[model samples]
Target: MKTVLVIEDDIGIQKQLKWSLTDYELVFAQDRSSALTQLRRYEPDVVTLDLGLPPDPANASEGLACLNDILSLQPECKVIVITGNTDNEHALKAIALGAYDYYQKPVDADVLNIIIARAFKISDLEAENRALKSANVGNTDIIGNSESILKAYRTVEKIAPTEITTLLLGESGTGKEVFARAIHRQSPRVNKPFVAINCASIPENLLESELFGYEKGAFTGANKTTLGKIECANGGTLLLDEIGDMPLSLQAKMLRFLQERVIERVGGRQELEVDVRVICATHRNLAEMVAEQSFREDLYYRISEITLNIPSLRQRGHDIVIIGKALLHKFNQEFNTQVQGFTDSAMQSMLHYAWPGNIRELQNKLKSAVILADSKYITEEDLGLSARNAKVDTLRKVREVAETQAIRHAYTLATGNLSKTADSLGITRPTLYALIDKYRLHDLRNTETEN
Candidate 1:
């Protein structure tokens, strides 16, 4: 049974509510303090708050403050405000303060129960949606279907099941961390923690302590013994994001940990064993760094046992549009906008533009467009892409580009099945084969035989 917190001070009404709302498991509180106590203890999804809460039942001040406290403690809780028949002002104020709904006093048990039911239903749905979104965050967040992305996906599929220390090579904002999470989700260590630390983001002086942790009295202000990222991720995965930016002084300790699967806290001499699958990602050229003597050669070889090079957005062909559309949909839901789709000009501009920041750039542009777009479809101006900046294409060139995009999109949707791709494109197998050969799509053709 779902739980409901009833915060009313009146004895007669409280008794009436208890008798009427028999369908739910109800917890009663006569004042603000007790309501908060019950709220924390039960963590009920639905709350029916009385505007005449004790210590000042004549004025709505105490009740409103209680409502504020309840929302601050649990923002998702559905707070139904009970008000006097003439208390429209307080009711509106309650709604503005994030109360779910309001009920007028001289309560009709049936009517109040209906409102409470609706609140519970909506709360359940929001919780369910949040749960689903969280479940998909690690697995389905990497959205792409282009051959380059597919190849990366295939590589992840092969390496995710193993304990090999994987290195993800990609341009910044190419979602190296997303790929890292994907690997962790697919691996046997899926149930365990996946801790990530950015070497560049943290100061060089603190990077070692952040990775290996420090003990109490290990250094100044070290009040308590703490577990490092590696120790926290024991039996799971640790992503050393931007590993290339790690300071030379700390690289030796990292190398030792990687080779021996052991780490020593800064203040402590104990060698703690950690069995974590390490994944390193960076935009820098490690080989060049090694040659330049900035990065250790032994550390380079240890992390790069298996390397997956993530393709830049410009190189992913039609995937730019695919990723853009997915992001647009996500932003629409997030911003509560009714954006149908992108305008033709916007679509073309996204396809032709050089996305220097890759998926991160695409996500930001779409988020802004979804919020600021006035019309049913988002325009190029909304995406902040100027027409003057777009490369002009001849009529024939435009036609060829459209055809190529269609074929590739259909081919990806069909999962490289030749017959399915041909049928989806409204062309015969022979014509599809000829077009594939004409376009020199060797990757698609090579993979099609396996399908």
Candidate 2:
């Protein structure tokens, strides 16, 4: 169970709160000193701080000081300030001092409980996101736990040790180069150079020279013989990024080099034997390009000895938040900011957004947010996401959606067997039937013969 620290000095109010909020593990502190001690002992994520305490029961001075102290020690803790009926000024002041929220006195347990629950839920999300970061600590380049990412990672592990040419297929900013480097690092030639060249970035006339190098006086600027990316890699790996953009005229030379393991430099006759492992990546469909005759089919077949498909941010599910949190921590240090986790609206926006640019776009938004956020927690505005775009649902609505999905999934998995579906859902047959009827799953009832 989650813990909550209650820092109210009034014995009656404390007792009333303890009686009413029985769902959580509650710890009480009557003053600043006791509050700090209890805070150290419990390290609770949520705290109810009364802004009128001993030594100054009539004012909020001591309580505000206590709030500052609590935040100083635990900046991530959610501190909810309780104030007098007319103490709006102090409540706002407390908020400025890093309090999570403020509540006016004449305590209504239902409202306060709702606030506390929200705090805990946010805390849980941050904790889970941080945990995901820790889980990927060993992998410096890739960060995710979703099945799609895991499947790609598994493929990398299997192919990294081999000399097979790899073709990475994914949208832009999906870390295709990262996987290329991973393959290089895991190969026997890791100690050698690992080079990458983007076919799309270089001019069509110059890409061949860039890959195979140029001899002295080969072109206007060729002052001396220079090693190209392919030769520079030598025994290591060379990643040909955006290979689909390679000029059709140059693909034959590339194919020849790949086949013969030798390259004739521009304006040179001697073929230099090269033993470099090759990896190719592209956001465009090579097969489609080949069908259009823009890309060489022979080169495509040679480069794609092994293929890995990277999942986009939308397809990775909860990995989006995990990667976002990881980026937030990274930019925090780089920009010298102490921004905490995202707000409910901000998280919902992130989840709902399509992220067409993938991790690159996420990194840009987070870097900007860290530098410009006014509050400790990042809001939806900080992320450059509009609240109007977010699909924010109530707790009841979320629960109902989850229930409906679960029931439908279980029923399909059980092949419409009523008893088996109930057993898989860990509910009684009667309850399963009632839920099916409640959700109006008439097709399932019509198909199944109540086994």
Local accuracy of candidate 2 as per-residue lDDT tens digits, 153-267:
8888899888898999999999999888877777798899999999999999889889999999998989999988899989889999999999989999999999999998999
lDDT of 2 at 243: 94
- Clashing pairs counted in every model: 0, 0
The estimated TM-scores of all candidates read 0.58, 0.68
Superpose all Cα atoms of candidate 1 onto the true structure and report the RMSD in Å to 1 decimal. 20.6
List ranges where model 1 is wrong by over 4 Å: 1-139, 388-451
Residue 268 error, candidate 1, Å: 0.5
Q: Write the residue-wise lDDT of candidate 1 on 101-138 in tens digits.
A: 99997989999889999998799668645544443333
Weakest lDDT window of 10 consecutive positions for candidate 2: 131-140
lDDT of all predictions:
0.89, 0.89
